[model samples]
Target: MDAERGEGSPHGGDGRLRRRAFLVGGGLAALGLGGTALAIGPDGFRNAYARVVCGGVPDPPVARPGARRLSEVEGRTVIVSLPPRPRDRTTVVIMFPEGTENARASLDLCSADRYLAASGGRFAVAAIDDWPSADVVGTVLPHLETQGFDTGRIGLLGWAAGGAEALRLAAQLGSGRVAAVAAASPAVTAARAPLRDLVDIPVWLGCGERDDRAPQTETMLKGLRALGATTEGGISSGCQDTAYRVRVLPEQFAFFSRHL
Candidate 1:
């Protein structure tokens, strides 16, 4: 955008911000070789871009309850929650909300308490901050292992942009390497183009049928299924926006539990 019309990039001086500015309103769509196009509008992307310049921002304080604490790993602040009693098989659930502030809240929003209790000692829910790359698994897993987490049966659950990361991580890690992958209102722009690499990993995708994000999620699921990825997807009936409703929490949680 021109200098006069400056709603594009939050930080107007940088070349990087200039490029990101174009995506500020329209968001990003995934398009590439033999891949289906997926659309993710500016809402989640804007939320993510807002965190880019947060150089000195502090991590969100631990407030949500249930054996919660903050850990600085790989220069990223991760919020981890554990159950009262753990199990032999640890189901590490890595969540990627738009920003650190939404990390812990996403868990509670999903009613992690019931599932975590039902999961017994088998599940650990961790939410990450920043624009984490696929190597995030390497960054988070070791810490979990050192903390007495079994490091087996890893699952990825995400909302909006974070859902994109969840799916991307599953692709990077591949089938058996990742036990289950669930996403709520996954934004197509969150994942890079060429989703066929995720053909082996099963994805449980949920979207609000009435939201603008539904078309995007449906397109993404169709493309992945065409590639032979074992996938299950549904539109939640009682939501206004598809980004993590009060309903799909247990539905997705049950999927993860079955796989774990």
Candidate 2:
């Protein structure tokens, strides 16, 4: 057999050489042969692949306890409730994500009551109504006060679109009333309003590596960094089944424990 045409030869007549040559030529073409490389480079391709294969994280356990209407403001109904363990010292304020009936469904699915109870009575959970056009923090402040909550020790938590809303509320309240904020797959787009001074507040951001909402989380992180905020982020371990994972909740609880 001719040396160049042997099975192990780089230029062998076998199919492998042709395939390798095609791949190399395609890569060079994509790189413009001299100019800047393609915007979607090899790394981008890999990331896209990972997202497609891994899927989104699992949703946190739902807190299903009979809902009690707390107040009605601007045609919106706000609610408050005690978690399984009503004697918990920690107070959690949850801002439900935006949209219609689905938003309410998300609040129910989150099961804030169950989460707090599972945390060993470490938190007393409360939730606001669906997305509204007013200052949610201001709307709920009075109710929280009546409930004997020390606003200074309160932690803000939100899910999906509500995550951004929660952060915005926290920023508005400042570090005095809100000690920390937690978000899961926040809908952080360019058009999303910017958060106020958050440099002194602690923030926890959670997203599934393969979540469709990853871009939003990335944008939120960038905004937080610009404000010189102290931010911690993590990839959820369970992204193959549920749309979000549980790591964010525990991590958020820990953050509140330390800060609040």
Candidate 3:
């Protein structure tokens, strides 16, 4: 497990703009305001703020040759991105988007499809429009198998509250069913009831050192280690924003590739 750090602090003209937007967007999120309003404010903040902070107000992913969307999985829509040359039976990475994002937007934010394509079809990426629970995994796994994914080897990725859901799902399902998990700024609670189930699971946890969730991420890392779980993680320099995602995602993808 390598320690990765994001370089530099927000400064200068562009950096100041980014820093300002980050503060505004984070404040809005804290107030439970809709991202739609933040991204499309009546003022020109959309062009100036979201462009730097909220990942430019993610658009619905464009329909293309290799892109696939499925609506038959228990009435939940799933967005799938296969590698350029997918294998017959490849591992799948399921993404649990943060509250403000949809499946396609989540995938876009993480650049997951491009990473899979760069992997040369080593694995597939799937994002569910709805947050998943342990019960949902039973449905998702079988459905993915039907779609040519090797359901036995599955990776879970998520951010913010979604990351907490991924952890809860991994705990409920256990390591036998879930191959690995990668979480960024997960809003994990202090409850230790689920720690035992994660002992056998491979986890990679990351968060921005200045982010509100940093303390919890540290606690989780310590808790996992105390349980002897194969855990690897680090705190970087950004928050729950786009820069943090850029810094952590490549390593997260590599972590999944190794375990899944």
Which model is ahead, 1 or 2, in terms of lDDT?
1
User: How many clashes in each candidate?
Assistant: 2, 7, 0
TM-score of 2: 0.60
**Stretches of candidate 3 above 4 Å error?**
1-71, 119-121, 132-135
The regions of model 1 sitting more than 4 angstroms off are 1-66, 74-76, 118-121, 129-135, 189-194, 238-244
Candidate achieving the largest TM-score: 3
Q: What is the C-alpha lDDT profile of model 2 across 32-66, one tens digit per residue?
A: 43122235554444443343455434455554543
The global C-alpha lDDT for each of the candidates, from Candidate 1 onward, is 0.62, 0.59, 0.72
Per-residue lDDT of 130-222 in model 1, one digit per residue for the tens?
A: 635535666678877776676665888877777777787787787767888888877664245347867777788878766567877778788
Q: Candidate 3: minimum summed lDDT over ten consecutive residues — where?
A: 1-10
Q: Is candidate 2 or candidate 3 better by TM-score?
A: 3
RMSD of 2: 12.2
Top model by lDDT, which number? 3
C-alpha TM-scores of all predictions: 0.63, 0.60, 0.71
Cα RMSD (Å) per model?
Answer: 12.9, 12.2, 12.2
Write the number of the candidate with greater TM-score, choosing between 1 and 3.
Answer: 3
lDDT of 3 by residue, 38-151 (tens): 666534455444434533323322423255555557676777877666777877888877784667777777677765555444677788765543245667778888877888
Among residues 3 or more apart in sequence or in different chains, the pairs in candidate 3 whose N, CA or C atoms overlap within 3 Å are none
